[model samples]
Target: MAQLIKLEDYVSRYEWNAYRYPSQFIRMKQDNWKKLYHLWRNEAFVGDQQQANMEPAASKWKSLFKFGFRKTAEETAKNSDVTDLPATENELRHYFLDKLYPVQLKWASSTVTEVSFVDQTYYANDRLKYFLKRFPDTFLVMYHPVFNVKKAPVDGEIILISPIGIEILYLIEKQPGTLITADGERTWLVKEEAKSETKILSPLLALKRTEKILKSILKQADIALPISKVVLSPTNHIASLKAPYNTKLVGKHAYEDWFAEKRNLVSPLKNHQLKTAEHLLKNCRTTAIKRPEWESDDNSVFPNDTV
Candidate 1:
């Protein structure tokens, strides 16, 4: 899963230490998975050999210990049934993907911070889930972030910082089988089956505005990073006379290849990537109150190597 480094202007652990949290999150996830797997294996061991032979099943659960929830495993397992245990490697993996993924996203985005003050809308949003869960862990995302420009807050599209470069993404969600036609700078035409064509304000306007803001900030910081703009519609087709000067248009046909290329990327956290993320977080407009406990004993809650 891609790490949600920032969500809106909510206080993020990444904002506390961009250089450290990514690696720490990866370790935490691994450790949690191991703990859950061991618990599952132990619960699966059958005590009665005759019953085990009669059943002949690989494993049977005595309890279902919810792995990634905020509640402790013992608490979550109270009402769960023995039949819910994952019996195979694939089943266990799917269980994690379905249930524990949200917990992982939460831990990566807002752990060790005052998450209550943050808006809860995006926590259940499908679009945000698509961005956070569909990409690799190495990809750090700033979802619908607000940046400070000349002391004015400016909203931006989704920005993804990877090991090698930055991607400014504008996701267009239209009905499946719809065709999106590029018009001029101000609008684009959308064609739906059995309905009249309509024009909507171009997504590029927002893309350009965000690009300009990022460019200006990076310039001031003297940080040179490869930046690219993408107009992506994962479920629709796009038709363009010619590609825009520096932007890439990705629609349904090419979505798989584009997605595969990103998932295939293999690299450790790069120094430049961390530096760029730190600078960007510095310029973002964040709204959060200090946790009362932290105010009393600030150093006590800082995340450690063990997470």
Candidate 2:
């Protein structure tokens, strides 16, 4: 799953320490997956091995563990808890998707803030799921992030930071089989199945704005990384007379290939990658309240130095 480093202007634990949390999240995810696999296979572990395997994720997220990741009892009741052990492989995947994935996202995005998202509604959002599940962990995404450019806050499209570079993605989702014609800088024509057409504000405008903001930040930081922009639509066919230079246009027909290329990329987390993310995050506009308990109970909220 791609790490959701930032969601809008929501506070993130990643924002606290980009270098630390990404590696920690990867470790936690791997460990949890291994536990799930063993449970699914019904493999017997001897003595302490079984105990260790059964340890709840609360131990991993020491800070948010107290509030139980801030989920209400009713919300928690919606899905089978991970400890119940899934009976089938399909159920196992769903368990991870339904239970663990949200926790990971919360751990990555919100630590000291109250993120108001209705449980079922937020979980069922297809766009959020696409960013989380379709890409690898090495890819860190900032969804609709707000960046502080020229001391003014500017909203941006999805910013994907990979080991290789950064990609600004503008998603243009429409009704299935809708035809999108990109012909103007101000608006694009969307033709639905009934042949009714409408002009919507071009996503390219936002993409270019985001690209410019990132470029300004990167240039000031004296950090160099390949920055690319992509106008993506997974369910609509995009027809463009002239493609924009230094940008990719991925419509429905080519979505799978583009997605596969990202998933297939194999690379270790690089220093520059984290550094770029850190620089960008530093310039983001964050609105969050400090966790009340942290005033006196900082120890519980933070991992031990040894960790």
Candidate 3:
């Protein structure tokens, strides 16, 4: 019979830990600010001053600094706007940090480094996961599988490995506007107001690039699998999204029906479906760095040294 494997069982430790970056980054920022404040205080108050005056000033500064820091962190955390909080440690990590890790350094290097996203893509993915969990025999759903393409990392939000083919889902959250896109265009038009329209990056093109990278990775494994792209909008409606014919543009309400119909069309070869699932699980698992064996001559290397 076809067997389903949860993401935790199919992925490596590295991939599982990748999602912790968001929380870690937040903590690091807070810590760094405190360190900076202490350093500044040490340098600024070098001269001899009354202990009473110094104590009051330090207390005031500390309280103000803490209030500001807490407010800022809370805002950052709330910015995710994900309605469904993750239940497991792995899910929570991925829910908060997966999207940020790949581009965190890039944004950090930029002149304007405030990274914010309106789309609740993670929320959409979680909803899909909730639905897929019901069928443990026919589908293997992977969430946010990151791959290295030409030395650059690319993230595939959702990958459904089935008997028919591999369906890659790109989640787009609801926007406060009417969205319109034209095939072959890199930018999409969003009309938020009656008189003004803004251009945003095309999710279709992003899905295509993700597909290309995924294909390259599978090719390296000598595994040729049929692949298709899907744009899933769980909370938004596209007024006019002119996507390519090959791409499946689906909305939240229609997804369950569409998935059921697709599942029904699959051939009833249970054993074949199981084999295909196993093959993908084996090849698509992220590569984790192995610890080096302890030896006398291995002083130059550490226990976590990986090839």
Candidate 2 — worst ten consecutive residues by lDDT sum?
Answer: 297-306
For model 2, how does the per-residue alpha-carbon lDDT over 92-206 read when each residue is reduced to its tens digit?
Answer: 5655554455665566445654432324555556678766876888998888888987788899999999999999999888889899998788898999997888999988899
In angstroms, the error of model 1 at 119 is 3.8
Best by TM-score: 1
| Residue 154 shift from truth in candidate 2, angstroms | 0.8
Q: After superposition, how far is residue 148 of candidate 3 from its true place, in Å?
A: 3.3
The clash numbers for all candidates, in the given order, read 0, 0, 0
**Candidate 3 similarity to native, TM-score:** 0.46
User: Cα lDDT for residue 244, model 2?
Assistant: 79
lDDT of 3: 0.47
Over the stretch 1-307, how does candidate 3's per-residue lDDT look in tens digits?
1122323222332122223322344454345444444533463255575777566545543332222111234545664343332334455334323332222222211112122221233333445434443333345455555554555545655677665677878777645444444334477665654657777787777778767766765675556678888877656555544556678777656777776675565453244434444444443424333233431221111121110
> Alpha carbon lDDT of residue 136, candidate 2?
89
User: Residue 116 in model 2: shift from native, Å?
Assistant: 8.0
lDDT values for all models: 0.73, 0.74, 0.47
Q: lDDT value for candidate 1?
A: 0.73
Q: Please give the lDDT score at residue 253 for candidate 3.
A: 64
